[model samples]
Target: MERWARELTARLPALAPDRYAVARPPAALAHRAGHAWEQLVLPAQAAARGARAILCPANLAPLASRRTVVVLHDVAPLREPGWYSDLYVRWQRAVLPRIAARARLVVTPSAFSRDEVVELLGVPADRVAVVPGGVDERFTPAAAAGPARAALGLTERPYVLTVASRTARKNLGVLDLAARRLAARGVDLVAAGGDRPQFRTEADTAGILTLGHVDDALLPGLYAGAAAFVLPSLYEGFGLTALEALAAGVPVVAGARGALPEVCGDAAQLVDPTDPEAVAAALERALDDPAPWRAAGPSQAAPLTWDATARAMDALLAEIVA
Candidate 1:
């Protein structure tokens, strides 16, 4: 959402008729227990002072906004309640429907998510607008691939890549098992993201290189050099990383769960993220069938761009304020 905020602020300066302001509540508080109450109070107070409408990227927000638009990323917690802890699951079940009812409008990242929201939250279809995300032009086919390979010492063996945080829904445990199965066959698995300790212990480092983070300038080269990109996330609103990989001309293998299947469409190899064997088999197939997948790469992510996403958002802001 930072990317969206920055891009929007850049696209339409605050000096325009509608002032663009992005505020981050006390982060330390928001992550802690009882912090939502303490952290939200200020934004609730600020909502009245020229903050005509508030846009929430996540389902929960300060309930005291003047005119609100809540962007429900997914209905995962509501649909698959078991996937989350009891407190979190209970929180969403209690709060989301209330937000949906009270918000002036709702926004979601993909059509799949929109449908799920309607089904799970009982919001009408017209209430949700599907404003898909976009890719950075930096992650293009023309990006330098060899430099990242050399820097990471991956110049020799072919490596598959995935970029996901250490969240449970990212399904890194399944990828770990798949890497173990592929290791006996001498295939390399390189991942970028996850906690430092988790990557150290969980990832298959035999031929794997796990960097917690890299400079933005080097990220495109990393994407461009990969044999393929894998997104084994069990749930996603819109798999932006998958789109970035496709934009970088890297063939994608993502889980069919949530909006990932819709985002990847036919450009990716969809697998059951819970099945390690399936993930391993899909990885093997993606590694072997290079010609067909690579041929479909350039056009796969051609439709979405930040410029388009910004325009859609701009139009939404105009409508909301009008």
Candidate 2:
């Protein structure tokens, strides 16, 4: 969400300097003060400035603000209530639908998420716009993976990677059998994300090396050094991590469900996240012969740029604020 906001608002103001201005919460209060600021302070400030429209890019928005164009990044809490705590899910169930219905227009990251919004939240399809997320320019095929490998202490063994949090919908269990299978081949399954307090869950990380919350600067190197990147997520709004892996010239094994197939295109090997055996087999193939996937990845990722996403957002802004 921070990435999307930073990339978006960075480009948005340039697109409409005369009309667009950014209002940031105190750096200390960013994540800590979202709800209260979003509901009460945001709309009040906008109205005071007489802003024509407000682009709430990170899902949550002021429910009463009719001029709000809220971006709903998948409607996951409504779809997967079991993944979150009772308090979190209850609040999501209450606020998300109301925000979707009340906003002037809704923005989503993919056609799959747009459909989910329409089907699950009863949002009109026409009201939701598809603005696919992008990869950073720095993520490209590395000439030498040794430095990155040594930096991450991954020089000892080749590893298959998954950049997902320890959440149920991430389908980390899909790695249970695969990790064991790969370990037998002198390979490792390395996971690089952590859990949230609102997440009422625990995953068995047996046979997998869990590196909680890898630094963002190390991500490009992490993706580049992997023998293969796996995204066994049952669902994704935009599959941004897989796209990054592709951009870094790594073979990707992603779930066939959600927006992954479309986001990955023909660059990645798609398999069922539920069927552990199939996902494992696909990962093995990708690890063994990464040449084809490596060749195909950059081209597939090249067109999905932050500039393009921002341009699309600019077009939408033109519509709403005109």
Candidate 3:
């Protein structure tokens, strides 16, 4: 979400200096307080700025605002029961439907998510736009792997990588079986990303090497060095890391479900996320024959840039204000 907000807002303003402005809450007031600010303070601030239309980059938008364009990535939180905190589930249940009904436009990252919005939120098809996230230029085939490999103590070893928070919906445990299966072959299944407060999943991580939270600077090297990248996420609005891996010229094996297949197109080896054996087989295929995937990566990722996302967003913003 932060990437979505930061990347789009970073580019949108430069397009029309006088037209776009961003409103932010203090960094300290991050989660709940930030939500409060967006509900109570942001609308008034938008009014003060004489904003014609406010773009709420994240899922939620202030109901008080008359003209609002909201970007709802997915409805996974609302779909699954007992996965998230009761407070969060209730809040989403109440707010998302309202946003769907009221917001002038609701942007999503993929056609799969657009369909989810139309079905789950009951929003009309015309109001939803698919503006997928982009891979930064830094992630490339030539990125130096030594520093990142040494940092993570992964030097001289082949590893399959996945970057995701240990949330229930991420299906983090699915890869543990695959990790153990691959261990015999001298390949490690490594995971980056830390835990979040909103989730309560007790996913056992006995097989995978958990790197608490990797530095952003090391990500490119990490992706470029990996033998293959796998995301066993049950639902993904947009598989950014998978795309990043593709951009970095690594083979990808992602969960066949959700937006991953759409994002990966034919570049990645997609398998059933729930079946560990299937995931393992796909990873082996990727590791064994990486040439095709490596060759296909850049071409697949070339068109999905931040500039393209911003251009699509610019069109949407223009439509809303005009």
Candidate achieving the largest lDDT: 3
User: Considering every candidate listed, which one attains the maximal TM-score?
Assistant: 3
lDDT string for model 2 (1-322, tens) is 7789998888888876886888776566655476788888889899999998888889888986899988888878888888888998898899999999999899999999999999999988888888899887878887456665676677568899899888888888878899999999999899988888777556666899888888787888888888899999888988999999999889999999899998999999999889999999998898788899999999999999898998888898888888
Error of 1 at 63 (Å): 0.4
TM-scores for all predictions? 0.83, 0.95, 0.96
Any residue pairs clashing in model 2, and if so which?
none
Better of 1 and 2 by lDDT: 2
Task: List the global CA lDDT of all models.
Answer: 0.74, 0.87, 0.88
Give the total clashing residue pairs for model 3. Answer: 0
How do the residues 136-218 of candidate 1 rate in per-residue lDDT, one tens digit apiece? Answer: 78988789977877776665566788887655677777876667766666666777764532112343334345676665577
Q: What is the C-alpha RMSD of each candidate to the true structure, in Å?
A: 3.8, 1.6, 1.3
- Each candidate: how many clashes? 0, 0, 0
